[model samples]
Target: MTADTSMTTVKVTTEARDRLAVLAAEKGQSIGAFISGVAERLPTAAELDERDERTRQALKKFGIALAISERAEGEALWAALDAGDDEALLKDPDA
Candidate 1:
């Protein structure tokens, strides 16, 4: 790697500076090095898109499972209510 002698100035809020200082100290790094490390490790747009898609798929699967469970419970409740079985109506069908 070539020597990185370039310099740039960044403006940040006092609170942000304090937080970065604490984090840099914890990692035994200078504030500039800590910030540079973070910039280098940031996820690409494609990686973020893939993560979002996976999350959406997982949520969709969960929603389908929840819908199926609700339908089963509703059917069980209606059946017990129609039969006038109070004990059965209060019981969990999946238990």
Candidate 2:
């Protein structure tokens, strides 16, 4: 990967700053070096893509369950909706 030489400022709480300072000193690294090391460990594109795929699958399953629940009748439908039971909505007889 190409190196990112751009510099940017990040603001954090005083408590967090102090904690990071101590951690950096303990490791015998400059604050910038310590922060850079932490940034380097962040999720890559493939890891983010996998996370997005899992989230999409979960949402698709919930949507299907909600649609099935939409077939419920009168009070039962209202009850399920009020109770926020997506699975109960899927048990509708006419669905």
Global lDDT of each model? 0.79, 0.73
Residue-wise lDDT of candidate 1 within 9-92, one digit each (tens)?
A: 899999999999999999999999999889878978787667666765787877833443564577678888889887886686
**What is the model-wide C-alpha lDDT for candidate 2?**
0.73
TM-score of each: 0.46, 0.43
**Count of backbone clashes, every candidate in sequence:** 0, 1
Residue 46 in candidate 1 has what lDDT? Answer: 83
Q: Which stretches of candidate 2 lie over 4 Å from their true place?
A: 44-95
Model 1 deviation from the true structure expressed as Cα RMSD, one decimal place: 14.9
TM match of model 1 to true structure: 0.46
